[model samples]
Target: MRDFSQDIDWLSINTATIRKQHGQEVALNTLLDQCASAGIRAVSPWRDQVAAVGLNSIAAQIRAHGMALSGYCRGGFFPAADAAGLRAALDDNRRAIDEAKILDAPCLVMVVGALPGALDGQAHYHDIARARQEVLDGLAASLEYAREVGMPLAIEPLHPMQAADRACINTLEHALDMCDALDPDATGALGVALDVYHVWWDPKLQQQIVRAGAKRLLAYHVCDWLTPTRDLLLDRGMMGDGVVELKKIRQWVEAAGFRGYSEVEIFSERNWWQCSGEQTLQVCKQRHQTVV
Candidate 1:
């Protein structure tokens, strides 16, 4: 494995990690500048954040800083209430792909959606199998466009806890299955974004990483999973603060030929978000070197 202890050249902030500073939402431009000042080389910003700051402007700013994107924030929410909704989701994903291209992102991270209205606490249906099928179908359509645009799509399998709402593809194996089914040739255009916070508990994680190899392992996200958890969605720990074995996982990933950024993606509303962005980023850089 590469020695991250030497420098943060391999470190990339997901932007969401420091989106909120001291309880206030910081602008994407401000966050970008801060990241540049911190000597961070890369970032992965969300579509909504890019939209707020304007696509052209953000693209220009990234170039000015000589920065690169580890991956794009998102472009998957395929499950919907009806045909019209599914079509709308596809349209949105296409636009996201274009935006990701504009930003020169390495890949567009996908958090394939589950029961249409589940995130809002009112699921449209209780059938999970149907949702998975929708996700498969949605990915097929999106991949067609992604290939045409020469942009890769990285499907991020959320933890099972998020299967009901955030993503139905809850395991790395399942994500790779979808990749194989869609891109049978193991083309670089379709792959998985492995996040430690989501897959650390899986018994077959190492085996699956070998299965994914280099071509299918498109992106990697890191964040410790906290114990005595407060909010399942918002509570996330920094590296070394939780039970995850960060170094071991990275070893497996590197063995699979994944040479990419260790993007920090934390959604800590009550902890890190309450601190200044500077403090949170400093901690992220420090912990990444020592523990991650």
Candidate 2:
């Protein structure tokens, strides 16, 4: 594994980690400035945040700050209740690809959606197999456009707990399978974004990472998983505060040939979000060197 004790050259912050300061949304431009001032060389910003600040404006700000994107916020949620909905999802993803291109992101991380309306406490369909198929089809179509545009797509296999609403592709194995099926040669156009919080508990993680290898491992997100979590979606712990074996996993990832930025992507509602952005960022830097 690479030594991070000396400098944080390989570290990147997902803006969502500090997108909220004192429970308020921080503007994308402000977030970029904060990251630059903190010596963070890269980030991953969400589409909504970028849209709120205007795509061109945020791209200019990123350039001004000399910051690169580890990946774009997302371009998934393919499963839907009807044909019209599926078409709409694809259209939205194409636009997302365009936005990612404007931002010059390394890849567009996809959080493939599960049953439609599940996030609203009602699922349009309970057949998870159907949802997975839809994800596969959507990815196939999206990959065609992504390849043409030279934008890589990183399918993020969200945790199983989020399978009902967020993503049904809940394992690294499954994500890699999709990659193999869609981009048989591992051409770098389609791959997986491995997030520690989501996959830390998987028994097959190391083997799967080896299977993914360097070519298919496009993006890596890091955040500790809180024990006795308050909320499934928001209560993420900062590095070292929770039980995730950060170094061990990174060792596996690095051994498998992943050399990209270790992107910190925590979504804490009760803890880090309540603190100042500066504090959260400082802790991120400290944790990056000492623990991550």
Candidate 3:
């Protein structure tokens, strides 16, 4: 119920939203500078971008510019074809957790992988339930390290359509179930990253948000879903341009005590990505104010 119309003080940009501006990869440093200049306070940088720019250097830049991270993107993809692969993933996730702590991110978002190799049009395993189990096991291992390091893990439930490839955890309820199962004590080390683009269509959304409350809601992501969609992966809509009930969901979230950044996390390859980063950001601000 807070007013975003006056200023985008609560707005944060997920760097991937503008990773490719006008068909070119936007440098993380340049993007950080742009967000700061645009009065955007926080960001959530992907690991690849951070790795490309050197973790220490990016951490220094973030500190120098006084920027905040809404969350780290990301540290999950637990499913694998073999035990060695699983061990490697666990090792990589531990490193990711260390990196997240180094950058002082509030939480590291988890995009729990499904079906092993389905992302590349070939699946190593077709068992969705098994994938979910792997994610839970991986999270349990990661959580132990996270508690020691004082970092939080956020499980972001991808949309149902992406269940086969991106994430098997595709509902707020499902994500919350994992949190409850793992961190039953309501520990702050584990929670869910609620993205409207993914769970906006779920009938149980409001109830789940209330169930999540403040402690289990680690991050809030926003991006409208385009109707008559083009690419399933891309073609995300700007906040006001699509059918997503942005304000209604935010109210549920805020009422549940989640007073955090409404991070814009669109993956628009056809529309926004084809436009200048400046224009895309300007629209993000306007939409954040008027619609979100």
Using all chains and alpha carbons, the TM-scores for the candidates as numbered come to 0.99, 0.99, 0.99
Q: Model 1, range 1-292, lDDT digits (tens) per residue? A: 9999989999999999999999999999999999999999999999999999999999999999999999998999999999999999999999999999999999999999999999999999999999999999999999999999999999999999999999999999999999999999998999999999999999999999999999999899999988877887899999889999999999999999999999999999999999998999999999989999
Better of 2 and 3 by lDDT: 2
Evaluated against the true structure, the overall lDDT of model 3 is 0.93
Give the C-alpha miss distance for residue 61 in model 1, angstroms: 0.3
The per-model lDDT (C-alpha) reads 0.96, 0.94, 0.93
Q: Point out where model 3 deviates above 4 Å.
A: none
- Residue-wise C-alpha lDDT for candidate 3, range 1-292, written one tens digit per residue: 8988898889999999999999899889988988888888899999999999999999999999899999999999999999998999899999999999999999999998888989999999898889999999999999999999999999999999999998999999999999999999987989999999999999999999999999999999998988878988888888988899999999999999999999999888888899888888999999998989
Residue 155 accuracy (lDDT) in model 2? 97
Cα RMSD to the true fold for all candidates: 0.5, 0.7, 0.8
Residue pairs in collision within model 2 = 77-113
Candidate 3, pairs of clashing residues? none
lDDT of 2 by residue, 177-284 (tens): 989999999888999999999999999999999999999999999989878899999999999999999999999999999999999999999999999889999999
Worst 10 residues of 3 by lDDT: 225-234
